[model samples]
Target: MPSTSHTAPITADLVRGALDLEPTANGILPHRLPARARARNTDGQLAMAESQPSGVRLVFRTRATAVELDTLPTKRVYIGAPPRPDGQYDLLVDGRPAGRATATGGNTLTIDMSTGAVEHTTGPAGTLRFTGLPERDKTVEIWLPHNETTELVALRTDAPVEPAPASGRRTWLHHGSSISHGSDAASPTTTWPALAAARGGVELVNLGFGGSALLDPFVARTMRDTPADLISVKLGINLVNADLMRLRAFTPAVHGFLDTVREGHPTAPLLVVSPILCPIHEDTPGPTAYDFSRLGEGRLLFTAAGDPGERAEGKLTLGVIRDELKRIVTQRAADDPNVHYLDGRDLYGEADHAELPLPDRLHPDAAAHRRIGERFAAHAFAAEDGPFAQAEE
Candidate 1:
């Protein structure tokens, strides 16, 4: 914590809508996933995604022309691969895009999949300062990088800052995979979920973790316990890509996940969303692989390596997951009407694909994110039978 004697210091409390903030020796670690649930997660993917702080932002009321944030970010580096984009920090003034930044000087974690070995080398923390804003006091938001695992070290502004008052908008809690994690999206605010939240006029608590969003019980329990007027879980892609479970295990896991979430939010508008169209994974089973041929061409692409024949063995596919999701939601909705299902294809389908191809063949590009967000806002939040209509009303 920096001294507020000169410039006022802001803490995680000023960072509105985070699921949980755990005190760390450095400062505070904003966790989209809670500690108890994290303990149950043995997968490294979830650990990295949770710490990335997608949709996490520092919200405050300030008149300062300049604001500075000190952060320690853990960035991953893959050997024999192109460098990942630098982490981006998005700034909003009075709920509009104001500026953007990339924090330098962070620890690097070297990953070598050839040997399944990892190494970390620490670096000094860096400060990001956003300045030249209007002098009048206004609501300001600093959206943390959606990809880098960031630990907030300190927050300082030229003027004293206070937590921004609640916007009175309903909170939308969403859990999904990389596409929802802002995978190929240009910036934090441009992420599909964030764009949807903005378009729907709601506060967002995004649980979209890249390479995660498997039907983890802890995630469901977290959603169960969180305060949200609207909740949604986008399923399928990660499970298919990771090949973590068979259809037998997946079906029950989805059911159990929903069952657990209902334990806390029995009546909240809980929407179950199936994965959107991924041509490669629609019929083919995955463990997807990166197309390294395009890798050197300055384009990174992924291909579904799982054979189409694997479906005979009950392997999971997006098509299969979608059917199962629709079936489960329909069956559950008969007894629990507040629960609903949205075909992910409705947001992005074959038609949308023809116009806006997924650049990476897995994640949507920035424009596609906006398109999905708009479609989602219309269908899931604004439609006559939408879950949000009942919940928000």
Candidate 2:
């Protein structure tokens, strides 16, 4: 018999890439791709590389903050999809256009529904290279069209890549509202969750959706099924903003959410975070709206809540919701030692609010994001046995 060393044949299926996402009626899934390059050998016969694109995920998670005076020029801003027919995205970085690109033809990157990976053609591939980026720590500001639908698929950075080591460090799964989702933040890496993850020296899986951080049963189920060494849920705010539930429904819903997560992560260290200070919703119930006619050249008007009844019902306020989150987490902690609670106000309070007022009176600005990240790292991940600490060997 002849000695045979056969290599597996490469097929079209092997050559194809995909990005899987939960289905939506519009057939568009909102997602922000990892800002890194990836390559793999398929069937030990061929290699492929996927690069990050210049789009951010599209979703109505947070509104833009007021343009600041100290904005840096070196950063780049990325918007999802493309500029609308109005040519309205007047994105500025230090008062200049950041980068102009359209999502057209094969140039438009898409999220592969089957695999959750962002995919785009490399044009005859042989090492697809994406260029154009400013140096590190620069500020990027995105001005999205009001009421426009968008999907951010990927991000690119100019900073040096420091790949995580093969071993060591804990893995943290952070679930939260828009702030954790990089709302109003300059870059994906600058999001408070990302910043805290970096400072704490851990790998992070961010499930921080912008406006989708409600204590939904489906979300709880997703959290229950997902695996992580550490986990955190940032609650409140959205509940208050949407006025999704009454006090009676709110408390039980939180309990049910935590109960479900506990089913899978019984012993894992879990932290529940409430909303930080927001004077707009601090005492009053709100369906917040913006009068953009004055700011955006009178061409755009933004409306969030149409129901005044919900606001008047006094059902949802950050003050009330925060208390409920604390109560539920406290009660849950009595039965489980690994569970912990952190007041969102501790990370940011009225004093900080006075100094760094949110442009929309909700989400934090970039500087506030940095402050919150640093504070979280100090209080939540300071010690080896801290709230974000890994399970002991």
Candidate 3:
């Protein structure tokens, strides 16, 4: 017997973690940063990262035994690098992963790093279907691909669906670099932030933009406006890699960013996390470039481009950034008890690096992501003195 299929319109009320939704030609596109914040900058990498929907998902309650979603994904392609895999959609039934699926066709975004050229090729949307679910009412969460820019076109189920009721969980808003953006992670729900959120028993709003976590004023402003019970900003790696600022500018920028966030969340638990172990950039500054020598050998790796001697002229490195961050947070914590600091090395440090090294010399691999997520959960949520412990309690 054929099962009845009910089509449901994808609307803002059904989405979570995204700040804004843009009405697209075929569907709705989620944006981590609202339109006003996005309009203030023109960096292509940042623009791409914000639209990838790292922590965004659709949450609804239904008794459907089968479900389907139509999407238009913009998959990224590096002209000279290895082929990237198609994005996967992770389905969580009642907060546990039940199934995973990938769409068949979507648009392709090709990038030529050698010439800094980009090309976009449009294609038809594809559908992802899941079947054989429990027929009783349950909360269903469809976590979108963390690394792909996806548009929610349509949703179909065997039964009616409604927005899930609030779980009364504290919202943890986090902002960081590529590692936190699910780089090299297995799937959306397996990303370190997502895993940590699950362990912490909190809702997550991840603003981790890949290669774009520089302390931008717009990003600070956006963080200031967002509502969150707990907040964390992981800085330093992008600043070091991008060679965006030096010691003098970095201190002021950190203060300004924290000040802006405190304006809206004066009493919220604000955690400032430093960069993790990246040996390549620990003492050396960047403007890191791909190792073309290894690329031909079917390996994608990175090399530091800045000279070590440049450090004397105020070029920032991980070491320098960590010290500055600790000092700034210490100075501010004197009056504001809510602001706290966490050394990122405590999450993924020298020992972890030796056991599970970063595959690309930049991003952590799947195993490392799980390790970091577990460590983060223990340090941030389980510890009685941890910054996020109160939320869990």
Candidate 4:
């Protein structure tokens, strides 16, 4: 007789780290941002970034030794750049990494960055299967790829499965840019925020949209409404790189963003972090553009396009942002005792940058991700007086 295979319908309760789950024709698509916030935006980059499911995962419990998941992934392709790698699915059993797999076939989005052209090609769904698990009932978590858009199709197991109960961990809500979205990271669980959350033993809700963390009012509102025990907002890089605002507008924007968030979580431990070391934008203004010189060599690099002299006219730079953030936090902490600030350099600065340089001139590479994760965990969670520290009984 053949073993009975049980197919489990993917439901909202089974999904973790996602703010909303939309039902699709084949399965459910997890969304980090809710529809209300998304509806107010029109930027293509933000749309793509939010749909990537950076910190989202599927969690359940079963005694099955074999499990399978079918998914449809949307993969990106730069026309003149090197091919993008397949997205990875990380499997965890009882909170430990058990296995890893990558889906083969998926829909493709071909983009010509220079020409601003895009073409979409549909493809079939692929399955990720894991076998030879311990027979005892165990909790399983499947972390989706942090850089690809995936639609959860179905789940199958050799034995019965059910939704795992919450672990009673305090929820930590974080918002930031691509680095927090897991760009260039080895895997989803390895992203600095995810790794830090593990060390802190807290539930994570990541709102790290790539190239789109420009102090948007909608994003701030989203953060304001989300329930959280601890909160962190990482800003500056995106604002500087996009040349979206000058020092004049930035101060008020930051204040408004925090003000909105405080409306919901009046006394939650809120931490504001600055941008990490990016040499090119350290003292210069941006509007950073691709190093078209390296494009022909199939290597992507970035160079600051804005004039450094613009700083005299109030153009924002990393250095300026850091000073302003420190001042802002210091001023607010006088009345809002629970609010705090962490210098991004403390997480990864000149010393660490010399050892593990950012490969793309912007985003941290895999090794850097590990270093950032460990450092963030130590500074933000493990320290005796850290904002994310556990409350005394």
TM-score of 4: 0.98
User: What's the lDDT for candidate 2?
Assistant: 0.54
Better of 3 and 4 by lDDT: 3
lDDT by residue for model 3 (277-328), tens:
9999999999888887787778799988988898899999998889989999
Quality of model 3 by C-alpha lDDT: 0.93
**Which regions of candidate 4 deviate over 4 angstroms?**
1-4
Ranking by lDDT: 3, 4, 1, 2
Q: What C-alpha lDDT do the candidate models reach, one value each?
A: 0.87, 0.54, 0.93, 0.92
Model 4 over residues 1-393: C-alpha lDDT tens digits? 224389998998899999999888878899999999999999999999999999999999999898889999999999778777889899999999999999978899999989878899999999989998899989999999999999999898999889999889999999999999999999999999999999999989999999999999999999989989999999999998899999999999999999999999999999999999999999999998988677777779888998889999999999999999999999999999999999999989999899999887999998899889898889888989988888789
TM-score of each: 0.95, 0.61, 0.98, 0.98
Best by lDDT: 3
lDDT of 1 by residue, 315-342 (tens): 9999999998999998998899888888
Q: How well does candidate 3 match the true structure in TM-score terms?
A: 0.98
What clash pairs does model 3 have? none
lDDT of 2 by residue, 22-51 (tens): 233322222222212012112110011111
- Model 4 lDDT at residue 113: 89
For residue 359, model 3's alpha carbon misses the true position, in angstroms, by 0.6
lDDT minimum window of 10 residues, candidate 4: 1-10
Clashing pairs in 4: none
